[model samples]
Target: MSDRRLDDSEMATWLPTIRFVQLLPQVLDRTLKAETGLKHSHYAILVTLAGQGDRAIPMTELAQIAGLSRSRLSHAIDSLEERGWVTRTSCSSDRRTLTAALTEAGRELLRTAAPVHVAQIRALILDPLTDAEREQLGAILAKLTPGVAAAL
Candidate 1:
């Protein structure tokens, strides 16, 4: 059997959407590395750990929230630890459970990095959209996210 080709209407939407999805991350990563000496993945890990405040998050949970595999998260954590941006501890409730928490330096890093990220986001995405378009985009992504997540 042959696959059906996308018609013009579908191509019009999919082409730009796919291109933007593929390109935007690279753009952000380049900007992040240039200004902050961090890649987008490392930035994501820092942000995730920081979100939990004074508490440490278990490795499994952190991996899930960061959308990274255990091994990948482990490597990221190791790098972050080297930078004093993150620290890992054994969960007191379960000694075998390794946990990660953001450090003062990590928060400091975020203080520096978040603005760069936000500025890029505003310049690239939010600023370009009108209020209604932004609302519609939010709605559209909300509708699509579940199925996309389920597939993963």
Candidate 2:
């Protein structure tokens, strides 16, 4: 624990940032679940896989990109596999190395799910911020992401 405590000025900035970080996932998860029967983490995993085009990502890399523990990602992958949305396979030469890819069903589900998720993001987050504020937030996050990723 640190010896220093947040002062009023610091808390003023930190409180809402913390709240946004904490609550945003819950809000997004609820909306996604209601509209698409998918949670935000699962959606994120899908998006990450989709973003890579035809490539099948190694499970370790997927876990890092999806910001999930290896076990959590394993469970999520199983759930996704059960829904016919993803596939996991082992390398022929190296059976211990596994990779994951999105199936056609996953792509089709994203076609329906993306709009709802994007709309909610705009409504709850982006639409409220001015262009300048959005720029600043983007820059701030970009600067902080390296340190945060290193910690993870």
Candidate 3:
């Protein structure tokens, strides 16, 4: 095992990344909750559905896309449905399968929520970085995110 400790530069880089990883979700949750009466998780699910072609996806596929378990996704969907933000339908080709779709209300919610979400993201994440740092951060995150997702 290497006895080498993190250098000052390494510490500087790692500290913010660690703190951001910890703080970002809370910040996002706070913003989304305050602005839209929704949690960040709920907003993410709604955005995923809204962005999809036809605004529908199979339950299992949606869960995978959202990085959620089937039960968790189902519960979120249930909450959305209760809010009239989404609806579930039997798949026409396979009655055994189900699809979740954003309703008109859901799309409208997304429209209202997106600007707030983007603003929060800019304030908390993007605006802090210098242009070069932002570019570097984008490249680094793009490179690393897939590996992180794969692990999840």
Q: lDDT by residue for model 3 over 1-152, one digit each (tens)?
A: 78999999999999988998999889899888898898899899988988885756999999888989899999999999999999999999999899999899988998899999999889877898899999998999999989987986
Residue 126, candidate 2: Cα error in Å is 1.1
Question: What's the lDDT of the predicted structure labeled candidate 1?
Answer: 0.94
lDDT score, residue 54, model 3? 76
Candidate 1 wrongly placed segments (more than 4 Å): 1-3
Estimate the TM-score for candidate 2.
0.96
Candidate 2 vs candidate 3: which has greater lDDT? 2
- Residue 61's lDDT within candidate 1 is 94
- Model-by-model lDDT, in order? 0.94, 0.94, 0.90
Total backbone collisions for each predicted model: 0, 0, 0
Q: Candidate 2, residues 1-152: lDDT per residue as tens digits?
A: 89999999999999999999999999999999999999999999999999999899999999999888899999999999999999999967789999999999999999999999999989987899999998998899999888988898
lDDT of 1 by residue, 1-152 (tens): 66999999999999999999999989999999999999999999999988899899999999888878899999999999999999999999899999999999999999999999999999999999999999999999999988886665
Angstrom error of the Cα, residue 7, model 2: value is 1.3
Clashing pairs in 3: none
C-alpha lDDT of candidate 2 relative to the true structure: 0.94
